[model samples]
Every structure is written in structure tokens, then in C-alpha cells.
Target: MVTPENVSSYIQQGLECEYIDVDGDGRHFEAVIVSKAFEGKGMLQQHQLVYRALGDRMEQIHALSMKTFTPEQWANQA
Candidate 1:
């Protein structure tokens, strides 16, 4: 069974995230992912990057709602 941490770890593999918090059970998940890599990326590009990081795990995750932010963006949000 997949857990939040499993999803979190997947996203962390390819992205250099300042922070990552994932919530939910095996099928549904929500993530707050902060990374410097998202700085100049468009919404679609950012989402694609995250999706790529998840790779095959995307098949297992039924609902993945995410809030992606650059470090600068995150600082402003805080």
C-alpha cells in the first residue's frame, strides 16, 4: 500500500524541494511542494515536472492535488 511518505519521496527524487508535505491515504493525496526549480516555470510545466518525478506512481495515485511553489513564492506566502 502506498502512503503519503511514498508519494513525497517520489516527488523529492527529481526535484530539489525546499519543503514537501503530502497528505492522504493510498489512493488520494494532496501535496504542498516548494522548490527553487519552479521559479520561472509556467503552471503546466511545473505540473509536468512533478508528474515526471512521480513517474509510474502517478498510475497508483487517484487524486493528487498539489500546491507547487518556488522558494521565493513560499517565502512570500509565509
Candidate 2:
């Protein structure tokens, strides 16, 4: 089974993330992703970018919950 760390690593390989945290059991995962690339994107578009990065492995993941943010949006959250 693929680990959450592996999933995080996979996303990192394809996208430039400022900060990323992922947690999951073998089948389900949640991720908080901060990146400059997310700027100017809507919620669905942001999710599509992540989905593109995950590629085929997305099928293996039963569930994925993600909170995506631009660096500025992330900073403003606090």
C-alpha cells in the first residue's frame, strides 16, 4: 500500500509547493497544500491541478480531502 508520505512526495515531484502536509490510512488521505501556483485559480481548478499531479495513483486513493491555498491565502488564514 502507498503511504501518505509517498503521496506527498508524488505531488511534490509534479508541483512546486511551498508547504504540504498529508495524513491518511492506506486508502484515504487529507492534504493541506500551499503554493504560488494556486494563485488566480478557482476551487475546482486548484483541485484539478492536484488531480493532474496525482495522475493514475488517484484511482488507488479511495478518498482525498484537500485544502489548497496560495501562499498569501495561506498566510492570511492565521
Candidate 3:
């Protein structure tokens, strides 16, 4: 079974994000990710990027609820 730590590590490596919050019970997760890489991307693209980061683990992980934002959007929210 995939763990939260494993998921966090994967996302960190894959996206190189500045801020990330991951909460889950291994099979399901909710993540709030902030990265400059999302600046020009639409919602679908952003989610796709994160999904790609998770790799095939996405199949193992079940549900992933994500709140993605660009660096600028994160800064504004803060």
C-alpha cells in the first residue's frame, strides 16, 4: 500500500513545488500544491501535471483531491 510520505516524496520530486499539503489515508488524498510551473496552465493541465507526478501510483492511490495554484495565486491567498 502507498503511504502519505511516499506520495509526498513523489510529488516533491515530480513537481518541484514550493508548497504542498498532502492529507490522506493512503488510498485517498487531498493535496494543495503551489508551483510556478502552473502559471500558464489550465485546470485540466494542472491536474494532469500532478497526476503525472504520481505516476502509476495513481491507480493504487484511488482518490486524489487537489487544490492547485500558481506561485502568484498562492502569494495572493497568503
Scored by TM-score, the top model is 2
- lDDT on C-alpha atoms for all candidate structures: 0.91, 0.93, 0.88
lDDT for each residue of candidate 1 in 47-73, tens digit (9 for 90 to 100): 899999989879989999999988888
Model 1 misplaced stretches (Cα beyond 4 Å): none
Rank order (by TM-score, best first): 2, 1, 3
Of the two candidates 1 and 3, the one with more favorable TM-score, higher being better, is 1
Per-residue C-alpha lDDT of model 2 across residues 9-59, encoded as one tens digit per residue: 989988999999999998999999998889999989999999999999898
Candidate 3 local Cα displacement, residue 47, angstroms: 0.5
Give the alpha carbon lDDT tens digit for every residue of 1-78 in model 3.
878778888988888798998889979888999988898999999999999988886788889899999989998895
> Where does candidate 3 clash, by residue pair?
none
- What is residue 68's positional error in candidate 3, in angstroms? 0.2
TM per candidate comes to 0.94, 0.96, 0.92
Q: Ten-residue segment with the worst summed lDDT in candidate 3?
A: 1-10
lDDT of 1: 0.91
Q: Residue 14 of model 2: what lDDT?
A: 83
The candidate 1 region of ten consecutive residues with least summed lDDT is: 69-78
Could you give me the TM-score of model 2 versus the true structure? 0.96
Cα deviation of 11, candidate 3, in Å: 1.1
lDDT of 3 at 51: 90
